[model samples]
Target chain A: MKEIMAIVRMKKTGATKKALVATGVAGFTAVKVIGRGKLVTDTDELEKCREKLLALGLDEVSDAGDTETLVTSFLDGSRFFPRRLFTILAHDEDVPRIIEAITTANRTDYGIGDGTIFVLPVADAVRVRTGEAGEAAIW
Target chain B: MLLIRAIVRPEKKDEVLAGLSEAGFNAATMVDVVGRGKQKGIKIGGMVYDEIPKILILVVIPDGEKEKVVKVILSTARSRNEGAFGDGKIFVSPVEEAYTISKNALGL
Candidate 1:
């Protein structure tokens, strides 16, 4: 079995879901995650993220209302971008098809944070209800 | 530490939790998710229900205790003596890195 984790733009999630369902991938898990790639180019968006993060008490900032410090941090370092993570487990033979479906759904005219897909080998799977394991557990 | 992900029936969540706690494994993340095994949900009459709700329990534990932890989940997550379909699944994977946010520490 293969576990595929696709981090995608929130705007494209609906289409991605439709495409995956159409490909006969029955079930998946979607998680909202905040992450960043290499840099933050948009100052406006960076300010907003800083504000939200500080408001949520995730920053080790001396002052909560320091917009200056926030701006400085945004300009100098990393920034968080909103992303949706989709986790799908499928048979090895069907992985390529599933990736194709995801790619087609999330394709963009110009790609930046279009998202990323990480595929990993699964040691085993068990169907809790039926006591099925291995390939039989993934359907 | 290895990350053990167990997808099990929602109804059996408490048992799994109790069993794990009893086994001295404390930390875990639980998420409510929808999926189905080979049965592909339940088909009643002409209705095809393709997705079934399940709980996914994620536990990052010491690698050496993988088998013991899996045993705890299995015994608690299993439906019957012989087990049945849709009982749930457990997936084990390697954890390359880990951190504790409060302590600002990393696993070496």
Candidate 2:
């Protein structure tokens, strides 16, 4: 079995769920979590971003007056956004389809922070009630 | 340490907990979950139930004690003799790393 985890934006969760269900992925668990990544809003980090941008030879930041506004606008994106982690345990063959559905539902024009998907192997599964083990335990 | 994920009948949570604690395997996380087993849910009279409530218990324990831990859960969580549908499932997997957040300690 394969455990598929999709970390996605809160706004896209509904659509993603619909897509997964449509693809016949039987069940999933969603947990709310906070994550930090490349996006930054702190002053020092903003300054560093400006330095990197300048080093790229943008040349437009020669005037001190324009740099402040430029920096603010550059870092105006979200610092931290609520994310939902969707975990699904499925048959190995279904992993690719499930990942595709999540990506298609959550895709956005802005490339960064769209979210991520991970697939891991499950050694075995046993049904608690019937004592069924292995493939028979999961639906 | 290996990660053990057990999905069991919600009503069996207490027994499972008791078993784990008695066996000196107390660290676990529990969550309410809904799923359908190989039976694809049950049809009671005229009603067709698609999703059933289950409890998911996650525990990370030392590798050597895997069989013992599994036995504790299996005995405590099983629903009936010879087993019945919707009993839930237990999944075993390896853990690459584990950390204690407050102390910044690694492993168990």
Candidate 2, residue B33: how far the Cα is off, in Å: 0.6
Q: Identify the runs in model 2 with alpha carbons over 4 angstroms from their true place.
A: A1-139
Runs of candidate 1 with Cα error greater than 4 angstroms are A1-139
TM-score of chain B of each: 0.94, 0.94
Candidate 2 chain B: minimum summed lDDT over ten consecutive residues — where? Answer: B97-106
Could you give candidate 2's per-residue lDDT for residues B1-108 as a string of tens digits? 677889999899889877887787755555667888888789999998988998877677777999999999999898886777777889988754343322223444
By lDDT, the best candidate is 1
Task: Return the lDDT, model 1, position A6.
Answer: 72
Q: DockQ for model 1?
A: 0.03
CA RMSD for every model? 12.7, 14.6
